[model samples]
Target chain A: MRRLIVGLCWVVIPWYLLSLFVGSRVLPFPHAVAIRFAELAPSVLLRHAAASVLRVLAALLAASAVAVPLGLAMGRIPAFDRLLAPAAYLLYPVPKIALLPILLLVLGTGDVSRVGLLGLVLVFQLLLAVRDGARAVDAHYLLSLDSLGATRTDHLRYCVWPLVLPRLLTAMRIGGATALAVLFFAETFFTRYGLGYFIMDSWMKLAYLDMYAGIVAMSLVGFVMFVTIDRVEQHVGRWQG
Target chain B: MPGVTDRVIACRDCAAGYAGRDVFTGVTLGVAGAETIAIVGPSGCGKSTLLLTLAGLHRSSRGTVLVDGTPLESGDPRIGLVLQQYGLFPWFTVLRNATLGLAIRAKRSGRRFDAAGAADIARALLEQLGLGGKESDYPRRLSGGEQQRLALCRTLLLEPEVLLLDEPFSALDALTREELQDLLLTVLAERRVAAVLVTHSIDEAVYLGDRVGILAQNPGTAAGEPARLLLEANPAGRRGVGRTDPLHHQACAWMRRRFAEAVRA
Candidate 1:
């Protein structure tokens, strides 16, 4: 009950403060910003929010598909770790936004480019988390498993997977947030829909109230997404103890 | 004496070590049914490595380890080992872990678990070990003593013919450690399982072993193999029957000198 009330307050109070009062110039009354928010229309907000969420989720799914396997392989095999670790370090230092021009050039200014760019950024983050988590597993546990006559595959599935999964979920939480942030910047480049495009459009038109409103929308979406994943992690991967 | 009893595990001219240096060379030992041998060694000796080799987890550079009269292979199932680390799978509930050995063996045999039979045995074993009412608990939730007892239960649940204990009680407090040591002696006796227990404590070796084997380390050398069983004294006698007798004390004194000599060798 308390949580529900708090959630309602978070939504209602922020919408009023951003849409009604704060603006490029002080408004005499709350009615003017309210009229402008109404002008943005329900259809436009729904369409743009849907587009943004679909793109981000698609990118995240793609990233998870590729990065998890690659990370697990690198972690299990020492030679692979040695070969790929340096390259991963080198690529991670490069700001993901810097890849925007190349992505746009190759994939064009469509949703494809935005989703692909988001996935690319997420790969480095999730893979690093997987590798570190796998490496952090206790050597004794692996040795015990080996002594039990477990095959390598058995060792991996039974021992390594459980040990690393919680950490992997944590990584996803971080990676998802980063992907969302990068998507905003990436979309600001060339996009017809999404909250990023909406925010830039409002700013260009000098509608400061709409700009703040879009910012609030993006923040709310990111926070909700992160919290939802965190809760799922706790439920699905109950701590061993 | 050798073949009459049917030697379950035989380490023949075995040379074992860590990181390439031999700890002991041409070391021969035979463990028969219901026999309990304690390995007593000074600190930094290769008792742990020897246990690993005996368990068939490590390749002996110079010799062979035979189980059930056949050459033992890597990760041999005939040998069950418990380490001081208490390497219980933290993700598994106590029940799952206790049945892990049976499950693995059943899978290998292409047979499903006799669930009722296995559960009955697991419950009885846990009850004996004082871990009843905690079947659903995971390893991390257990205290150190509980974990050690669970580790014991897990090993015993397999009903392995030969048990290898590598300093299984070193991590516990002194009282708990001694209690566990006694519990282990009782369990091994009850199950009639041949066991090789490694420990740094000479008193423990003397107190529990049918025959205590002493190992010594060379100074300034990590690679020097601990000296072989220069002294094999049965202070505790058969099944620890005469453990507190004067004969036990005299045997301990004799073995103590041999251990000191091996260290200075």
Candidate 2:
């Protein structure tokens, strides 16, 4: 709590000083922006935040649900790894944001397109993370487990999943940040009900303070998502630390 | 207990290798119940491979490994292995690792895994192994000796009929190694499990085994030859005897001479 307070002071004081020097509508004062944020209807901001959160959550859930199992299979089984490794190497490097136009065209600019694009970006990140993590497990550990008469399912449950989870969470955190950034860009294109739309709309209307307020709200979303993942990681990987 | 028999473990002309290249072959050995056969060989002599084959973790390319007169199979719970590196799962706490075998047995038998019962067994084993207060600690937190004891505890909890150990005390300091060796002998005395210990140290082989087998490096043309039973001495009589005793020194001297000659040839 003390660190958070100190960090806020550092950010707020610097912004306030900069705003004072500028004294222009382009960079409104911090106090004015805060006041404008307070004046806005809570429901309006809440709805935008909720919509953005929903899209990100949906994308993350879908991506992990598919990627983790496939990644584990690829990591453990030589046949699956041999088949998928080449494709993973080929597709992992392509900038996923470039697919936005194609996704919008195919999915018709709906929430489906937005969710699909974000999920596509996150799937590769998570799959490769899990694959590498699983591959990194020491072979001796598996042999020991095998000698104990652990079945195939037991090996997966006791050895593979728990060992891979920490790496998976790390990948999820990075993927979450990337998803938010891409969400902001995707929101700028179509529809009217997201933080990106609200901020861009306020900027076009020359309401600089409202735009700053929208930016603050979106930053809160990112902060909350990251903190949640960090907490989950700590809880799951307590043995690590 | 159904498959338990008087014959503990017997290997008849077993051969093991990887990728079409043989590491060792034509190895015939038998270990009676409660007997310890120490294998001392030069590096790359396939000592570890023979132990793995006996434990059923590696397949014999030719011939057979019989555990209680039954052909050995991989993942046989009747045989337990203690790797040289002490292959304890880092993700599990010491207590959890020690109880893993018991839990698996319960699940295999379609019985409810009584967590409290398993914990009691694990706690007793840990206490006996001198790891009483370290149950919740991960393997990484324990010292090398403690980690070794924990690995032994994990395997012994299952009451295996055969124990295959690969240089189980090679990594420890001199003092810790001796202490662990004594502890292992004590445990084996009580459990009466057949054991095959692989080591590079002539003293360790002489100190631990009822009979010491010497494996020659058959790297190229001599791949299918069996290891010769180099020495059969009653080392168990010197259990409480000091290492510096005249008998111990004589045995060590004799083993050193024989081991050097075997490796050179």
What's the DockQ for every one of the candidates?
Answer: 0.51, 0.74
lDDT by residue (A1-241, candidate 1, tens digit) is 5765687677666655764656536332334444555666476655677778899899988888887887888888889999999999999878878888888899998888899989888888888888877777788987787667777776777777887778778888888888888878877866778988888888899877777566656766787787788787876576442
Q: Highest lDDT, which number?
A: 2
Interface Cα root-mean-square deviation for all models: 1.6, 1.2
C-alpha lDDT score of every prediction, in listed order: 0.78, 0.84
In model 2, what are the clashing residue pairs, if there are any? none
TM-score of each: 0.86, 0.92
Per model, kept true contacts as a fraction are 0.50, 0.74
* Candidate 1: residue B132 Cα off by (Å): 1.3
Judge candidate 2 at residue A63 and give its lDDT: 95
Q: TM-score (chain B) for model 1?
A: 0.88
Tens digits of lDDT, candidate 2, A193-228: 888889899999988888998988888898888888
